[model samples]
Target: MEDMSRLDNACHRPLRSAAALGLVAVLTAGCTGTDADTTTAAVGRAAVETSPLPTVPPAQPASQLTRAEVETAVSRLDGVVRDAMRRTGVPGVAVGVVHDDKVLYLKGFGVRTAGTKDRIGVDTVFQLASVSKPLASTVVAAAVGEKTVAWDDPVIKHSAGFTLKDPWVTRHVTLADLFSHRSGLPDHAGDLLEDLGYDRSYILDHLRYQPLAPFRAHYAYTNFGLTEAAVAVARAAGTSWEKLSAEKLYRPLGMDSTSSSFADYDKAADKASLHVKTGNTWRAEHVRDADAQSPAGGASSTVRDMTKWLRLQLGNGTFEGRKLIDADALEQTHLPHIVSEPPHAPAGRAGFYGLGWNVSYDDQGRLKLGHSGAFALGAATNVTLLPSEKLGIVVLTNGEPIGVPEAIATTFLDTAQTGGPTVDWLTFLGPIIKQAAEGERSPVDYSKPPASPAPAKATSVYTGTYANDYFGPMTVSAKGGELTMQLGPKKQRFLLRHYDGDTFSYRTTGENAVGLSGVTFTVGSGGRADKVRVESLDTTGLGTFRRNG
Candidate 1:
């Protein structure tokens, strides 16, 4: 099955995290000093000097804190953010914090675009990516609040034409099943189609062809699965998902700068352009249009607008002295629905998925809800809420995930609780992000062809139209001694270069694009190639297209 676990490494927006308080092995003792008195007689002389008192570290924020003590951590966010920017070179960051129904902090650091004078601000919009999941849940909660859609309602009751591979599973799956990502869809079931330029409707409808797990018993993170639930809720509300968000969530909260439409983000006068680090310089070299999975990962908003949503979450569906949505429906989004992270050790605590958020409980039994959004193309964001203390913080960045946003949040949160960050968060997060990014590449180096490769036959043997129900029809054509492979709704062309006998290589391009991948053709006794294997698309053993003739 080509190691389905590779999806975890390539996954830019991982739904679960291994960095929770109880899971990460934090080694706190690093000062490397011994305050021992070796000379007993010298004790009388300046009290044995005591090795200069071993450089007593600053007091850590308590392991737990009451509402009044959170200020210690919230106050240092400016310097914390500046240090993070200086250290990580993430280009731009916008942070907002809400406490006690008040805006505690609103600030930005670094330029909106690298190598430019345009500075980011609280109102400079940035793509939310998977963080949009939690916000979409808020919109759905409003639908639930108004009785337009129930959390447990079957999806087919609202959105038509949605089905899974199993008809019984299709008939029984609920919005909660999809929202919590327990619908048995393979990990990132339809994202490849999106990368190939397919729209949301095509991807959603075609999900029935992918293989399934044991229904709600398995936990596989699927963006389109969660998106399907949002589409259904919008259908039940008799509105589009974009308008449903505007009417039920954004407009009501006065989040004028927030939008589910990519056009709004594309044309924003003040927006942080997505960036990636290139040879020690941050470059705004990529454009990401997530309209296909709008509800799952496409929303964009400024910190000023995000703070309002934070206030709503901390206020139990209320905003500025008004009840906006039902607290019951909204709070349910924070309840644990599935086991997202099982402990590695018996003493560790398991993390849970609650609607769109990563749900966990602290040592104090306080509820902590958070979500991270990332696009390998560029854009990292995080939103965390401590509802027990009515405190929440959101961090947005316009760069590929390097643990910058998550590190900043973890530092602030650590300071708020324990007087200071107990661990170097970037030290842990940087390696994980780097590993995931590298893991998305082809295991076999197609760039380096096999030595003494077998020569290919005439190009005529490979030119034909091959069909697969999953990948649709793929046509390979050759002109003037060059071969091109075309597929997808647009029939996007991939120039094929000879790699070996019956094998050609093409550079993969898209969200899931790993690199140069093999396209091997199998010739039959009759002479014409019968099928072609596209390695990049065959993660689940489904990339082979058979001859239709």
Candidate 2:
């Protein structure tokens, strides 16, 4: 197995933060001199500074209000959202907050469609996009709760026609592998629109001829695998995936405004329009109907509906008068089965992975279980549950510029904390980072190397700035018989050596033992490095970087 832990140096971890109460003291200490003379002189002094000292009021007593108080403060948070929508080019957003089994706040802002005068409301339906994963995953959990499907059931057992490029790995792949995103396949393969073409069955049909990864590894999010998992859950439940979600999750949770389509969503009367930002303003774009990829990104819902779903999770999978689902199942969904370290996460540490949710810690190091999604030029969404505080947040936007979902979710939850409510995800999971090393297996990539090399003449076609709204800036410079890559200040002075026809590797200058564990660079026409791919240690996963020069 390739050791992904080696690539740990490629990314930086989030900064350590001080607790809210500790922040003031830390800042004060930093400002005050630490010299022995200063300490000696102040030995008999009062805690406060000398007389004419500015009367900085004592920190306001921590509010002891109820959840309703927190909700009310959050409800009046309209002004706090302008910047979030502005940065993401989203014209409107629907926000919801839930504490345990109750909906604390549900509201909307801006217009549903930018060109139109229609407004977004609490009941306005918008594309849930990848938020569908949780719902689809919930059904699978329900099936497990009822013994209809085993979490470890192999894909071939559920659907005999399935096959990958490698026959051996195909038969052995389990349903959990797909949902957990370790199934060798990447997010969307060659010309996804051409294969699936807005049709679900076609995607399943093409799965038979698709390639597989030799070794299942850590998380690399994939829509195809999750969709397959959704189908398997449907087959196990003896019903269609759509029907299963409606009956088991939607109806029981009273998510009347949620569905897999704009048509079905309209039944609720009040719904949000899908908007795409166009230079400074938003315009109504087609609602994403990637129903073919429904398991990955296809539900339409509102803040209220999502809040209700949050309550169910908070209530241990039961809602109102019905034990709609099992609490243990919900626990299973949040419990980390695989140790994964996603970007922006602390280095040399592995976070847990549930069925569809990527489990991690909030700024305070509290466990946070949630799933975030984005649709190209459509919308971005985030739903998070902090079980310890029995609090959750649902943030939906009609536009996305990457990272908006995570930012919004964090901001809202942090804001909620200021008002009497206290919810955290980590406190419930007992030292997740220190858990056992299970060495979970992910999908294996078996694609063969390219046939022949391109003509050998180089140009400066690689010199320019390529930006991914999420990953940050990548700069490539070539000079003095060498090419170098600078990914946000971290410079790589290395020789670009060719491997396969389109692939190349890097050898750091004057550095023998400190070589990059694994890296593949692809030069396009004109012998220009147009793509840079860092292979995961397992070689089954990928973090692809396209040439933007």
> Please, what are the lDDT tens digits per residue for candidate 2 over residues 147-244?
77776777778777776555555766677777765565543321132221325665565554444443354344456677777787787667787788
Query: Candidate 2: misplaced stretches above 4 Å?
Result: 1-76, 86-89, 190-198, 261-263, 266-269, 342-349, 362-365, 402-404, 418-549
Query: Per-residue lDDT tens digits of candidate 1, residues 1-549?
Result: 001111232342231221121122111112111000012122223322332111222222333455555777778888888888888889999999888888989999999999889999999999988789889999999999999988888899997688888776677678988887777788778888887888998899889888877665566778899899999999898889999999999999999999999999999999999887887888988898999889888999999999999999999999999999899888788887767656546675566677876766655556677777777677888787777677788999998777677678777777776688776777865556445544356667888889988998899999988897877799999999999999899889999999989999999876556678899999999998998999988876789988778
Q: What is the Å distance of residue 202 in model 1 from its true position? A: 0.7
Which run of 10 residues does model 1 get worst, by summed lDDT? 28-37
Per-model TM against the reference: 0.89, 0.62
Q: Mark the 10 consecutive residues where model 2 has the least summed lDDT.
A: 12-21
Query: Could you report the Cα RMSD, in angstroms, for every candidate shown?
Result: 13.0, 17.2
Task: Give residue 207's lDDT in candidate 2 (0 to 100).
Answer: 52
